[model samples]
Target: MSRLNRSRSFLWLAGTVGVTLLGSLIPLTTNNRFYYYDDTQAGAFGIWFEIGTKLSAGEWPLFSDTAWGAGNYAAEGQWGIWNPLVLLIGWLASTSPNIVVFSTVLKITCLCVLAAGTFLLAGSYKARPEWAAIAGVAVTLTGFTVYIDAASWVTGLMVFSLLPLAWFGLRRMAFAGGNPILALVAAYVLITIGYVHGTLMLAVLFLGLFAEAWLTARSRNVMFRLLLAGMVCGFIALAVYLPGVLTAPVTARTGGIANSGFLTPDLTGLATVWVPGSLPQITGWWGGFAPVPLLYVAWFLPVLAIVDYGRMWAGGKELAAIGVFGLLSLGLTLAPSDLGPLRFPIRLMPYVSLALLLGAAVLLSRYRVAVLSRGRLAVTAAIVISGLYLAWSQYPSIRMAAAFGLLSVAGIGGLYFLLFSPRAAPRLKSPAATAAGVILVSLVVAAGQHAAFKASPLPDYRMPDTPQAYSRQLPGAEGGTFVVGDPTKLGSQIWNETLASNAWYLNSAQVQNLYSPIMFAKYAEDLCITSHGWTCSSAGRKLFETDPATGKVLADLLSLDTVQILRDPAATSDDIFRDGPPAGWHESSRSADAVVWMRDRPLLNTGQVVWASDGTRLSLVSENSQEVVLRVDGLDGGSGKAVLSRLAWPGYSAQGASLAAPLRGYLVELDIPANSVGKSITLRFEPPAWPAVVGSIIIAIVVSLGWSLGELVLLRRRRPDKAWADRAMAEPVKAVSPQ
Candidate 1:
């Protein structure tokens, strides 16, 4: 019997890994292994992969002269500088800046983790293996997962794994007893909060869990313990999360949505949460909605939710507390529209999806397995037929509906056979059937999801490694800032811009390319003004097309002297192409892929003493994931301002002159002495942990660690003769034998 249980558990784990991998085949194996549509994948992660190269070189991976609006602000917290996952990937891909490969690996790995975590949590709650495994699928292949997985916003998928792990820990402490795994996982979720949604959604989920603990505590003391656990988690989160929290307000994302109340999610759209590719203007994806009814995706989900809700309310307050938790989470989705702080409303769907699926699984496990009574069979068939009819009626394309209907019937039939029927000489039961049901469901969902995701046409973006590079040099090699332009706007084939820009960077040059990193608000605006003359964008990026005059003015400001445009009409207006190079510049060269122009003199040299008139030279010294350094030479003699090209942050140090405040709000300048002339200077970046600048982060870290350590000690001392973890999780209530 024990061996059978062990086998069942192993199969459940393997089944999860198998299903996640099956779902990932289309995205992973495709030529477009990574989606670079929009900046989230290609341009944004393009910069991140560059930073990973710096990490490989063992440099502090924060500030850069080549990007961040050409020079201003550290490579801010928008892309998760401190996340463990980010750092780990950064470390691994340091020597290899292959964004596509790393992103695919991360996506596949996270999906597996999400499934395994959900399955373990379900088992910890004493769910039947089949139901628990289904819950894992429900969590992994939802609308939210379908949309975000394998996209540029892959970090959000990482949270799917963390959420389940955290829940498992909380459940163990609540229902069984205290254990190390729970606190550890909970702490990890809190730490990773910044990696996804800037900590907003994760924080909201934490609050919901807090409410659950309050309502469901077996005793008041237990409630205190739970609250303390939450406090501990928050403390550590703030310790790590403060820098991002402090800086995010200054970015373009600071403002609240105007008339946010109108952002309510459509009821129909909400119902089809199982579907993917809604109207981009509507559900924000290009594909049509799913063929099946949304609620049909969770057939047993709603049935079991009601059952669980009733059970919790009538007999088990502890279980009922979970019901309330789900309700609160669903309710929080509504607040995003009315409340000012939240951004996208769809962000709340993952939690609501989890609640619905988990509630269903718990009910399925704790109750009697449904018998194939004649009436029940008839009812199930009627429901399935009605669902097919509804699918056909709702979707515009009847063929898709028909196809979905067929799949549904097959899936339902397979599930029924696995759970209820014994084909040969009928025995009391077969546990192996549970594994079979998991496989059936996984196959159907994986196929449907792949089709739904592929329903909309993907952007036609493509780029080969070591992509096209221009053979010409811009005039600003001294200042290391030039402008590059491409014909296509921010659409597919955007890599023309990145490829040329990479050519510039590798050939020891920098560009004001159409690509923008997650930038400072002022820098974003400056680039917008420079690139488009008058167009403004609130998103933290701007295009790089410019009116002739605007181009010159922007060049002056950004310390640029050369402008290269790929031979394309949209980027090059006839004004300059019909005549020649604009005033103050002359055409230097032209080629099929590029045209280069030159300015007579340099812009503000990176290491200008007195902000000008000094024959000073600055060269990049060494850079890696942890730090960046620049060498300044031949300051011929002066107690003048030494202006550097890198942006000014609070965390800069220099070898020759004392580090002073920023010259403007954008560039870094230092006060040096006349005697410092002819002596080489090295400037380095080392930003302080701003969130804990006053030692609060340290204090919080110490207190939280101490509190957690104390709790562990107390638990051990109290249960000296027994292993609490073994009792709490390892000995999860065994599945009840069929009567």
Candidate 2:
């Protein structure tokens, strides 16, 4: 590479890292006691921890009865087991001393990835390296990304961070005759991240890029290649979602589009896009209004008045593509609250912000002049005043702060223009000086925004003592633990004070509490469970009922050894244990926060096969999350049933016995025929359509590789001709600038 290109690469890397670290300092400092909050603490960390633990132990955890409602890891889909980066993160975090510190580092690394991806995307549009870097920093620190995604929705953040890279790859292949391999690989990784919303955005991005290529290049070969690439990506997506699709009929996620208006942004929220700290009028997690500027894109977006729009409109294919993407994302962000399986329209804000900032970068790179004209200056002033007025009108209580934010924007714009425009001294006009000014201004604005947003919206009531605090406090149960309580009532106290939500996963304790988007509908309905895993008040009583098939209580049938009940305002006088422990169970421990119940005679065989019928007898040989081995003995001349304490996910099959109907509508049941005596049986659970899913993935890879090889051969043949070289050099650069 040339010295200039190498320097630009270095600046992009250093500026992204520097800005991410600096912008993240305020949240870290404000809550030094804990960096993760809300869903991140309650769900993501524990789920990832379990996934990492299983992976580290050389296990591919596809189904886990230990997790109860959320045990179908592959069917749940967002575990990201197929992605290598996610595997590495999970593996490293599994051994870390402090999960909070590890999680904090992981989030920061995601920010850096997001920033670098944005920079590359803008560079693909022929934006100067400095302008691209500014766009990167601005988009990286956008309110939804930092406060909403990084703070709580970590999987969403992981998926969002890769979007820009995916776009960059598609743009290169479709417009610049770049290698098709990179585009295929980028799309594969993005889809395998396993977040449905990101996958949807990728589809929209592909459409936008393809449309631009068709309209501007009009190359049949390019269009064919792009279409073929998209088809390959579609096959890859099928592989990722096959398990979920097969299991959807039995899962809680089966639903159509329904908008609850939750997390939906009002149209007026767009006015605060330029105000750094101004909150928008939207229905956010905090209700009524967002505490952070969830819609803020960049403070300097309004100051690109020096751009020559007429020239850009005539020749800028990149600008037109960005406009298309921005409008599509805007429409989606204002769409119904729920669109199919994806919810919360505000989740698309980061993409909208990215498109807007990248558009600004493309325009400035193509048409920014050395001096601001009088007419452009008047337009810039008008934009600034209008932005301030709209922001004040939406949030009248923060007029002073909005005015101050507008002044900051003006000051930064003035400084940037002075350094790059003709009015500045010649020394300040050098590329090095201008690049440094852009980096400095971008970092300053990001830091200011972080400061204004304050800490994450975390309750200060509870703090985790250590990564193993939950495991240390809660007793391990060989046969499962069932937590009965309401997490919404406990607030942040649920993290450290009780085994609620996914806290049981941290303890490696098999518990009924589950944190997953998809769950077994029958299992949830039987216990009156909510999607978040909170059971009804009467759930404890339901556990004591005797199973007619095996004459074992429901607790024994499910192999539960521990029961924890949270003490809250709603605890009534006639609680489940008010009359004392039922037969075969005793009160093991009690505290101000909760009461723990333990089975007096824990089931002797604590393996997968928990219960057997009168004529069937089984001995546990070996067991794991996915498979179980049992030796059958007493099924001599009569048919009987054997029940395994596993949720009846659609994939389970038995080798020696027929798959029986679900026992009590949930546990995996096996029918032992008359001749089945003294034989070993193996029960396994694989994703239902494993063969088809694997075939789809293999086909996609083969097709992509074949296409890439064909392109390589064509390129090699073209490289030997002098005429081809001259034409290539003379052709107007379609994707990136020559500089």
Candidate 3:
């Protein structure tokens, strides 16, 4: 590497980091609050925090009784429990749990990781310092990243951050024989899917790579090696992937959910990332002009890449087209047919952001704008603008079409310098000038946008710490059904103070719960709605209005025993004594945050063996969350049902009797014979045993490690084996460390 390159690298780091800090100065500097972005406040951050804490305490995560009867942890796609990082957080949370601190740190880590990944990937192409830095900074600045950070989509953040590195690895393997970094990053991503825009986002990344191999690698051997690299990546993370796929269908995620469509490209949003601070990523459309600066970096960068394509292609550049595929996806999103039912078009933003930045890197590598004729720049700009306009026209409504059309015209206007300017230098001054212009425009646009439409700030309130921060204690609540407050206040408390609330919003909620099939569904129900109006599931909510005769019966049927009436400041006007507490319950005690209530007739052991013929309900001797024991007079010669008070999921059985899958969404009912009544019968929710999963995980780890170790040994031996794609005398591929 040249001394110039090294210097450029350092400069890129400083400039990009400095600008990022400027963009996020408000949240970082504000001591009164940290970024929460509401959507993730309860669903993502608080829930994950609680999972970590519980994991640290040695609690079984797979089957949770906190919210509904059986919340499957491993099958919850977003949990990514198999990922080492998530597990580490869980472990850390157990010792010192602070949601704000953990969330803030994680968010920062993701941002830095993304910057590093972008830099490394861009630099790998031997791009000049200016180009590489621009690539890193530009991707980090876009609306894709802004919304992701605002919503606190930590999984998406982690995935996007690591994406460039993964692509870098893939690039090396496909173009430069093979690399270890590819395997490691692939494993990390496969283990954790949420960061790269959830499931569909991950699919796009793979598709983008597939396209790279299809277009760039002419050699079938190279393609096969790429395929092998993918296999290796999957194998390394198979422990998590295998179980996740298997249980997803039976649980909440059945068929992939249809969440795609309706994200038309905003031409002016092309430069949204250039805005200083939080301006670029601010929420709500400011009529598409909140951050408008009359000039944008988007106009300069794409045109730069378009004109520099001759040189980039000469450099054996396959990634250039691969990156642009991100935009192609946006066009597909405009189609009502759906991109095979992807999550959303905006979900493709991370890829789009990466691709656009890569294109910029190509243009900035040399910054010899003088090489391009005005005719060429103008033609290229016209073509690019045409594509965007076509996509905008596909929008379902005229309102959208007009909005996007306006942006296209505005974007075209911003390209004046690129197409017609004669002042551009042909050397170092060109790149330096371009970089300065991008930074200045970004800052100006961001500041302007903030001045126009500031995103709602993170709440000034702290994470719940005092007793008012916790749910009221119920002796019968643990390992049983319980409700904290009325339907209105049910899920509110889950994300407010606690990391993991007793809720069923976790993935594997049975797609009926989330209205999906193949894709992972995070939570279930709408008793508690998000600020965005997405209804979430919470079995912990009090009945709408306790049905006098049916409330207690239904509660007993679902094992609902305790209720905690939260003292809401807003609810002070409502009669807590009447509206809050359910019937057939007495006040236990009061806490800073809640007034405790216990059912006069507790349903702690609701599982009972009933003689069907006689219609006599027998008493349950003992029961836990997963198992219930009932003694029936089997010699009495009456067939019966072992009624367990819990929601029915697959894998439940009654020992020494037949188990009938519950219909009509009722409690699990098991058939019992009068002959066996004298004997003690046990009903247990026996999902797939942990030993098999543990064993498979162990085998997967062993295989992956053994392969990695072999690769390391091969690296030391320096063999140029053609078995994997490299030809004899070709330079052995450089080994990449596990990221």
Top lDDT model:
2
| Model 1, C-alpha of 25: deviation from truth (Å) | 2.2
lDDT per residue as tens, model 3, 1-739? 3456456556666776666656654344433234554435534654455566567567645554333423545444456655666767656643444555556666666666676667666666555555566566656555546544443555666666776767666666566655455545554654565332443444455666677667766688667766766665554344454554555444433444353223433444443322222122222233332232211224334355334445446654456445646666555433332333233344555666577677566444533344455566677566555544443332223553344335434443444454345663444245456566555555544444444434433222233532224433343342233333332343444334222232223321111112112322222332342222223223334233332422334445544455444544444444453344556776766655555566777644434421233453455678765677776653344676545545555556677677775522444667776567457777776444445656655665665566556766777566543233212101111321111
- Runs of candidate 2 with Cα error greater than 4 angstroms are 33-35, 304-306, 369-375, 399-404, 412-422, 428-442, 458-465, 487-497, 546-552, 577-579, 604-623, 628-642, 654-664, 670-682, 703-716, 720-739
Evaluated at residue 33, the lDDT of candidate 1 is 47
What lDDT would candidate 3 get against the real structure? Answer: 0.48
Per lDDT, what order, best first?
A: 2, 1, 3
lDDT of 1 by residue, 297-408 (tens): 3434323311323434454444553465567666665554534334555455666777777766666666534455555567666655554454444555566655655655
Model 2: how far residue 245 lies from native, Å: 1.6
In candidate 3, position 604 carries an lDDT of 49
Q: Measured by TM-score, how close is model 3 to the native structure?
A: 0.72
lDDT of 3 at 663: 25
